[model samples]
Target chain A: MSPDEVHYPGAVPPARTRFVRSLGLRLHVCEWGDPDGEPVLLTHGFYDHARSFDLLAPLLAERYRVVAMDARGHGDSDRPDAYAWFPGLIDVVNMLRDLGRPAHVVGHSWGGGQATDAATLHPGSVRKLVNMDGFGPPEEGFHVPGRDRDERPAPGQLAGWLDWRVANHSRETFRPCATLEELAERRRQQNPRLSSEWLRYFAAHGSYHTPEGWVWKVDPMAARNIGPFRPEWIAPGWARLRAPMLALVGSEPDTWGPLPEPMLARRLSHVPKVERGVIPGAGHFMHIEQPEAVARIVLDWLEAG
Target chain B: MTRLRDGRAELALHELGSGAGPTLLCLHALYGAGSDFRDLAAAWPGRVLALDFPGHGHSPRSFGGSYTPENLVANADVALAHASEAQLVGAGLGAYVALLLAGARPDRIGGALLLPGRGLAGGGAEPKRAEPEGMSHARFDVLLQGITADADPDPMLENCDRDIRPPDYARAHADSARLLLLAEDDAERPPWWHAVREADCAEVAPADPEAALARLAAS
Candidate 1:
């Protein structure tokens, strides 16, 4: 189960790995393709790290310099005392600044939301943006923190959350799996569309081997970081977005996202210039499920303008 | 009062005064703890029960360690249980939660004194929270007068977002027992301030909590 012993055949390691200071933490960054080529930054989803981009980054790197970052508290990045919903936006802006010029940014899930905010807040830092199904919960499922509606009353939700905190504080750790294959199998249950080989590769990079077993590197505190966020809040930012955007979701149902189509269409309507697409036979982790198909669309979108 | 254990977390209630009338349940500002209102509780007549919102003062970090309004109000509701009935005195973040509870548990909340607070008016670009390490003490002092020297900004930032405004303001103000007091110098007035057709809200040099409470007491 140790990292040194675990290996996934056909997995490609990044060309270079480095760290950059962000909000007093050293964020791990991975690079691929030509260092001199136009930069394309890849930010991963919740509980995922830069290594999650191993498949897509290489394809994007073929035509551009691909850089992926391990978001704070995930991967090799330094873990802070706590996590919040918007700090990722700050990190994205800082990364763009580190690039020293505008770069095309690609983000998945939570990273997609961060990338969208970063582009909206600091329009000059991003030339183009690609959001891979990070549109948050569907409007009907939206819960405005304190504004409890009929279906989900504040007391029950509050009690549930408090009970969760009592059980899982910052020091809480993920339950370890007996073996590396077990860990990959656990991930497969959540992301079933991903090939077993790819899941093994993902588990290897996303977890750590311990005397007890294999545990995820993601901080336990990251669970329930969504605070006071509303689906309506996203539209204003999208309306202000200056960069061209390519929004993609999987054609198939999955555990993570892609919300309903009418809802997706309405959400995308806020963007001044956006191209939307659905990857065939893919799920929430579309890029990993069908890297070639996902990459083909992303590459074409970035190159179109 | 003493810290009340609710099986999950310890709720810190700073009690003062005694005898007669509804308890003056004081909820401190975003960057403050129950201890911040010792002077107010000391001066107020009758029973006063000020709670250190969960994650503030002796109270432990909130459930899931999130200080979202939902969490804050939920924690405040636990404090509400300490009294048979109470009037709410909330400042800033506390006021935001007070308004929510006012509409939510109309029976428990007799009246609400909502002092100058964040996102009360609502509708603005999402407020960005200043990173804790990046914030200077001077800036911290400006916000809450350094009430708690180690006040974390994560919750403050989390509480002050685009959706901070009370969704049920009209319902919360269903009775004339609510007061929305904004600082005289508050440059940015919430849209609700102007939109309020006929609500008993005021904008003045910080309204005296005692007078507001006394007025509610007399009524």
Candidate 2:
């Protein structure tokens, strides 16, 4: 289905919604395509929900059973008191086990990194791994020194940091927007390539309407950094992956900062078996910007290997 | 990780070190699990038991969905019952909970070292910070991952409580055998630091567990 042919930009094709109990949280899951088809699991990045695959899942449904998960603290998933990476990796592993067989996994951004860890740490659970621009900073970029560095507490200063964070963020509040259209307009200003209709659809699903106004569904605390996320911590997972992997990045740089060629190469070198490709004229949100192109690339890779 | 049944909730307890010295029950702050005290436990002179408070870390969320001080205290009570006679070392919200337990059952708590608990002053103004314009989800994740790895303060949490009132400190102040560790140059101080001092709550710098131990020995 082409973007233009979609009469309901926000309408996701009929899918069954279910909750999976894992890691002490209820994970919201969406199932599309045929149950008999080969399973292909999709994971969205931070602050995004499973519905993010609406534009791409339909295209893959003809040949694969598409399942998308709303990671804990995002979308319809339950928000945990604290957020961490290892717990998320465990959740993915558990989901795969629940599926009862190895499945193809596709992850975007944060989810991409998690998918990499899943395929690497639990090779038996993942058949194939597709990373959509989820390679984080270069090895040297783990700690962005000087910028907001003071916010971080020293080795013995976690108590102070917790006090500061709780004192600052534990309150209940929402950003007031005039309407859903206004929120979509704000989103459009950031993603110029995304059509207004698609932006509205994304906003409708991504935000909640309060009596006062509309606000994002994501928990603000999910954005906080309560633990470690260094390259060393992530590289081991990448190095251990036994599944064939594909890395898809946008040819044009957009947001995720800029991944220089050398940096990208250095990061990808950890993956044992991997291939790389890029979508032209698309940025970080390449799947949304060029779903057809992304779908074609993913389908071709899945079919080839 | 030790699991204990606390009513309907399950508490994950992390234990470390083994010595003749008094057991140091380490309690972590909000948004933190008992694991946050790993380094502290390693450095302590005695056995250390850290607990993942209900709804945080591996501990299951409270059945009532209440994170109120009373509920947290009840969970802490369950954890405290499992440990031998111990000194209490708590940071952030953990500090507050520790003080509450100490106040309710001073006989069980040999001493309490509170790491600049929540009732101190300051942090009233909205922090002058801005989310970068046009930040994508990937960019945000990068920033978050960096901070998480570094154990740095998150900008997103900077001004979230600008309008909310600080937690009340009367109970903590009334607790017995409590010593407060005031970190140097802290950006966030309890609203009642001066009051705590006026009440003769022994205070130290940077909330050093070793120093608190020494002070307790002297006392």
Candidate 3:
């Protein structure tokens, strides 16, 4: 189908779509609100597109020019050969540079993690940062030994590792759905709070029609391990961020499950200036499930300081 | 979008572009993902289906850590089930597997593009040893530079921690049209290249993606 032919019924006022070339890949950016208004950048999580912000961007459009971008390998952006958090950080930095001014930045899930990294790595580019449950599993969950000692695969285990990986790679293939409704139903099962209309709208923009069936627009490679998941790999970024940061986690746990209170505190401890909040009755997808509440919280924070 | 399952391991398959032309089955090197062929897919006139070998990209880790040539060949067999007619373009470890696949399923594969690798005949001087436990992001970045000197390295290479004993290529055979893009030295060329009965081989600069594609098209 032609790009122009695709439409969402319950979508907020339509936004202009443009592409930015960064790090040799084309990134899709969607714009809303007055061009002269203060710019606010929005980034979606893994397997999600810029349109995932349809319900939330409009709410912020009144006072801020909101720009929602499809990270490489998702939505209309060109899929990079491999996915990495650093390149994503670079993309955000470039986008902020293009805006010609530091802007309020908000990220959801994987995007949230990237936003946190961006704010930390390039503080001058971000005025304020909001992370929505982006911190993934705690340091222990990564299974890598801490500073005490190093671990290495046993001598004879290499063959087994290779075999296991080949088997695992085969399973990461996209699963096709018979129809958009089917996709919506699957999504609904994951986040029941999302309305059917919004779910359908998300499926429409988040998936591509294939000869076999409808499949997510996300690149399968996006699911692969691109970097070490250890805490040392991430904590430095949190410590480096200079922008005022806010972390909004859902009341209920989702895929990553609940972050233990101690773990949450440990994760946030590195940040110098940060605040925390929880959205009642929402899960990991709090932005979509509680758009108004999230917008209000965000706006109130931005307006206060 | 097809799932090729073999016991505990499942391979991720990606099919891009569309046309009646020949399909290109792309296999990425060690620590590489199927999406590595995105640029090649865009340039090709035909369909391009790339597979993420088990434990590499989105695919599941093998229950047994089985990185043997036999298991890899089996994974390719399942990946091939999704395509009607396809050629093979494999890099590094992928190139080695392509050679094995061509030998195992001559009828299913068309022309083959094998990039830099010490072929199935195995035995290049042992690869420089790098301890995964001691790896830092900066050290990892240097490892990536060794793979491809691009200013920006492919993050997928981070998956290269697990190792496997190289397979002996001396016994493998290539029955179909095959193009071997040789690396700078014999260390990257399979011992079987000189013995392969039917194949077109060339030594091209590894950095030239266009030269490799041109060789594949011409072959």
DockQ of all predictions against the true structure, Cα-based = 0.11, 0.04, 0.03
Name model 3 segments beyond 4 Å from true: A1-10, A139-173, B1-219
Clashing pairs in 1: A165-B64, B121-B190
Worst 10 residues of 1 chain A by lDDT: A150-159
**What does fnat come to for each candidate?**
0.02, 0.00, 0.00
Q: Is candidate 2 or candidate 3 better by DockQ?
A: 2
TM-score of 2: 0.61
RMSD of each: 7.3, 14.5, 14.1
DockQ of 1: 0.11
lDDT per model vs. reference: 0.69, 0.65, 0.66
lDDT of 3: 0.66
Report the lDDT tens digits of candidate 1 across residue range A38-107.
Answer: 9999999988999888888888888999999999878998765456564566678778878888999999
The DockQ-based order of candidates, best leading, equals 1, 2, 3
Model 2 lDDT tens row, B1-219: 899764445789888666777777877776677888887676677778898876568876543132444345556766777884677777766775665566555556766676753422223322112322222335434544543343333322322222221233432433343554444454645544444444455565435556656664333
Clashes of each: 2, 17, 35
Q: Pick the candidate with the highest TM-score.
A: 1
> Which residue runs of candidate 2 sit more than 4 Å off their true CA positions?
A1-11, A138-164, A168-173, A188-193, B1-219
Q: After superposition, how far is residue A113 of candidate 3 from its true place, in Å?
A: 0.3
